[model samples]
Target: MNIKFSPVPVEDRERGRNGNCYNPGSPLTEGMKKQFMEEIKPICIEMERKYGVPAAFLGGQAVNESGFGLTRTGYFANNFCGLKFVGAWGRKPPQIMNGQDFGVETYQLIGQPDEAWDGSVRIIENLGEDRLIFDESSRYDNRYFKFKSKPEFFDFLCRITYLNGSEGRLYPKDLRYIFDEYRQNIQRGMSIRESCSLVACQLGKSGYCHTEEGNGTPPQRRCNYYSRVITEAMDEWNTYEWTKIALTQN
Candidate 1:
């Protein structure tokens, strides 16, 4: 099915909103989300068409976490969903190469993200001012992977969600989105909401946010809210696109 991700592309999700997730007057506005949606439209469509997980669900995840590309962390770090850096995150002990401080950490884009070495991954560094230089010899600590482009970053998120399996007895059981489990729903042809619920439930159990209820006090911990908010945003985005199609078709 040739699904065109064309939506009139509403006002950037980041701009002029009553109640948004992060701080008010955030720079990354809804307008940014509109662009991001188009930018990643191909990737999202490929994901949904190839696999059966609704593209809206994935869109929601990105919109929910990174505010559709208006987040400093996700923007500068290329970490669209706030995937923390862990386990050999940076150079083993940093290095000093010919009077220059350096460190080389395995690229986390592909392969098992662990001590295990993957020959294909390329190690690079963020050399300030939107400059990413190849420094396999650098030992200086590096945070999350700063993707070269929005599409690359989005692709990383998709692969992770569709790959990883059950983590051993370390942290929470369902602390991350297990794509294998989601694949079942994909095979069964689940609705977008169902897919959202399934992934949202797992995300709740994981790091989406604390699920425990409180007096809406400090932090106001609530599980699955992240997924809910993102999914809703994604659904609305789809509506705009669908609405455009409806009007044109008529």
Candidate 2:
């Protein structure tokens, strides 16, 4: 069962009529959802191979965090996991921009006049960072890491998501314990969906934002909601045609 991987279509990657990758007001279509899953499947597979994290779990998190890559942080910053840039791993803290701290330059491909002066050429530039001041979406605050590519984003996501507790705030004791529990579940031969549900519950209990509630929901409710959503997503992906084929190979 060989699954052919493909890049996201240029139109899907480009800014929509509202000047972002997909209009915020518009509902995400089935096509968009399928495209997002196709684009991320390879990256999730690679992360699973490297980190022992289940690909279904990673895919579910990406779906939950990014709204299937429709959110500003997910699409513009390539940060599918809702990771905040806290100057961890000795990285320099991002500079403030437009009254917002933790600013990172974000790049997007746009059509510009070609060198020949005849036709427009697609060039990647830091246009997204410039748009932050005017964009009213609270999620577009420029406070997340900006990656040049999806692979780079997923690699960093894996590191922080499964970090040990040597660092204080960035990799806290509870997060480390969550990672250990996930590993233990895997070692115990738990199904990916089951393991992801348990980890999602742990994340909710540890005050992680697995959904967009943003401290509005009660901890117990949030835990149940996050776990349910994650488990549902894993179940869907486990049955998806490509994912089923990919899992056969695995």
Candidate 3:
């Protein structure tokens, strides 16, 4: 008998809220917990479908240090891994903003006169537009912290962050456990279909496109490959086409 695939999607548990593992002093909240799982899970899945870093691992790390994202500094800094800034022009880093800025820009769809324009400008101005505002915000840091290649990143996450019932060495053994778990789940006929359409829909809804280096180079062709994933996935799911053109102009 063929076992049916269940795309019920196992959401990562919120450590601070659901498990109560986080300290009471932790800022972890029920609302943020809900948002994190609801929002990040799909993102993780899309990333995993393309990059192979198990969604669980990314979710686990965010839950681990950030108290499921309740840490004030974590929330403010977007420093999900507690990764430090080692780069220099070398001197003791200033305490005022010594973290990676996620560079989360804000905007509004309203025409001409708008409140968001002022808000967005004020935020950029207040921060002095220095860039390097947070540790995880930098694509360079994100690439460094994550695996060198997408495959390496996937393997590393499985070992270092995810997996149940272990917490000693953060590599090799940890990765082994996580990989085994993935195998077990897969053998059980887990849905391995890689569809980027859902990701495209989400990203489209949010009105953003991620560039290869985040240097604002008009999004590379390879990066736009994600759009293909979305298109194909949508075609498979409901026989619908997201874009009228076969592919966007290069």
Runs in model 2 deviating more than 4 A are 1-27, 86-142, 164-174, 210-218, 239-250
How close is each model in CA RMSD to the real structure?
13.1, 11.3, 20.6
lDDT of 2 by residue, 1-250 (tens): 2222121222333332223332221367788789888888888777666665556777888886677876666666687765654434434322322223334454332221121122222234333422212222222223456777788888766665465423324334336667567768767877656777887887786777634565557888778888888878777766233333344566
lDDT of 3 by residue, 1-250 (tens): 2212111111111211211211223344577566755554554555455434445434544454455444332443344443323221122223212323532221111111111121322121112222212222212221213223233333433333333224223221223333444445545755332222333323323323333344333433433544454454333332212111111110
* CA lDDT of each prediction against the hidden true structure: 0.45, 0.56, 0.33
Q: Give one clash count per candidate, in the order shown.
A: 15, 0, 12
Where does the lowest 10-residue lDDT sum fall in candidate 2? 111-120
1 or 2, greater by lDDT = 2
Model 3's TM-score against the true structure: 0.30
Best by TM-score: 2
Q: What is the TM-score of each candidate against the true structure?
A: 0.52, 0.61, 0.30
lDDT of 1 by residue, 145-237 (tens): 456666665555554434332322212233334555665664586754665556666656454443335224233224356556756776677
Q: After superposition, how far is residue 13 of candidate 1 from its true place, in Å?
A: 30
